[model samples]
Target: MKFATQLIHGGPAVDPEYGSLCHPLYHSSTFAQQSMDHFGRFDYARSGNPTREALEEAIASLEGGSTGLAFASGMAAISSTFLLFSPGDHLVVCEDVYGGTFRALSTLFARWGLTVTFVDATDISAIGAAILPHTKAIYLETPSNPLIKITDLRQAAALAKRHGLLTIVDNTFMTPYLQRPLELGCDIVLHSGTKFLNGHSDVVCGFAVTADPEVGKRLQFIQNAFGAVLGPQDSWLVLRGLKTLKVRMEQSQSAAGQIVQWLESQQCVTKVYYPGLPSHPGFQVHREQASGAGAVLSFELESYILTKRLLEGVKLCAFAVSLGGVESILSYPARMSHASMPAEEREARGIKDTLVRLSVGLEDPADLMADLDRVLNG
Candidate 1:
């Protein structure tokens, strides 16, 4: 089946017991067994739920993975996935990864003895140079958060394979509909399902998917042990949201292209970072690996004054922290996503005071342009 069809029919879509079109929510914290001699597939909520199971199946199928694990939030998914490594092991991660991930690794994981080296993943040489004898994995976020820097996933995965390291990618910015990293030789695919997968912004969720059964089993163990699983109702909501993935992504990507063009022409704008633009550093590499440029883009203003004005003055786009909702969201990395990082470190990673990231939504491109113009020109 094609992507659109798979969105609707993939996984355990039909209610096997009730014959309902949508998967029914199984809210019980524990399941009953017919006999003590034989345990059922699910004994406790922490281990699994029928509702969450359906959503997990959908994500795994969408990403072409053998297994999927759902979590309460994106951070939970990421932190738990990192648990797959031992304390003495090291990891090479994209320097511009999402702030929450950076914080977790630099503070929590580091304290636990999981060392990491941050590198500019856009340069394959940088990734290779960072590898050490203790390195166990390479974590990446392509069209990386706030900066929109793209990494060549296939090349990176190949390099990891040579070093016998796991290749894990955060596929939040480019949902499986746009880019399937597992197919590009990545060992694991991760997502902040709160973003595009749940598109409506009503639920907070995350997923870890893997094509290798062994990796899947390891993640499943961590998920169960950590107990950060998504609740049944949120799983149902995300399942409902998955049906419209194709249409929502198409509309948002179209709007983003229009907005990128307008931002490039604005006098107050100093630079725009979007894979869709030909001038973007990873334009060709991104095009070769992914089906679309995705809906998020970041731009730099002429000054911090202009940046503050535009972020505070946008009338149509919400000045908010989260993105990938039905409404456009404008966020400041220095104060929002990357605020946890030290000033010098964030600057070194190119997340500047004048940089603003935008998640274009389902709104009409013309209205969005007019609203942005009013804010920037006013």
Candidate 2:
């Protein structure tokens, strides 16, 4: 089936028992067994639920993966996945990963003895050079957080294969609809469902999916043991949100392209980072792998004064931290998404004080541009 069809019909579409169009929400914490000798598939809510299961199946089918695990939040999914490895093991991660992921690794995981090496993943050679004897995985965030840097996923996956390391891609920016990293040879795909997957900004959830059954089993074990599973209601919300993934992405991406063009023409703008732009360094490589440039872009202002004005003056676009919603969101990387990173380190990684990230939404292009203009030029 095509992607759009799969979004609505890929998983268990109807309530099997009642024949309802929407899946039924099984809210019980425990289930009764017909006999002690034989038990049902779901014994406890922590292990699974019918509502969450349907959402998980949908995500697995959408990403073309064998298994899908859902969690309470994006960090829960990532932290649970990290539990797959031992304490002495090391990991090579993209330099500009999400701030929450970096904090978890640098503080929590580091204390637990899981070392990490951060490198610019755009250079496949840097990934190879960073590998050590104990390195177990390569964690990446293409069209990376706030900055919009694109990494060559296929090449990086191949390089990881040679070194016998797991290739994990955070598919948050480019959802499964735009870029299926598993299809590009990545071992696992991760997502912050709160963003594009839910799209409504009402639910906080995450997912971890893998095409390899053995890896799936390992993650499933960790998910069950950690007890960070998504609730049935949130799962149902995400399932409803999945139905409109294709349409929402199409509209948002179209608006982003128009906004990027306008930002490039503005006098206050210094540099714009978007994979859709031909002048962007990774434009060709991104085009080779993904279907679209996604709905997010970043730009640098002439000065911090202009940046602050734009952030505070915007009337239509929301001045917020999170993105990928129906309403446009404007964020400051230095203070919002990447604020956890130290000042010197953030600058070294190219997240500047004047840099602003915008997640274009389903807003009309003309209105958005006018709102931006009043704030930027007024």
* TM-score to native of every candidate shown: 0.99, 0.99
Q: Which stretches of candidate 1 lie over 4 Å from their true place?
A: none
| Runs in model 2 lying further than 4 Å from the true structure | none
Tens digits of per-residue lDDT, candidate 1, 1-378, equal 999999988767466678899888799999999988999999999999989999999999999999999999999999999999999999999999999999999999999999999999999999999999999999999979989999999999999999999999999999999999999999999999999999998999999999899989989999998999999999999999999999999999999999999999998899999999999899999999999999999999999988889988989999999999999999999999998998999989888899999999999999999999998886
**Candidate 2 lDDT by residue in tens digits, 1-378:** 999998878778576677898888778888888878889988899998988988999899999999999999988999999998899999999999999999899999999999999999999999999999999999999989977888999999999999899999999998999999999999999999999999998999999999899999999999988999999999988988999999999999999999999999998999999999999999999999999999999999999998999999998999998988989999998888888899988989988999999999998989999999998888
> Residue-pair clashes per candidate, as listed?
0, 0
Per-model lDDT: 0.94, 0.93
In terms of lDDT, the best-performing candidate is: 1
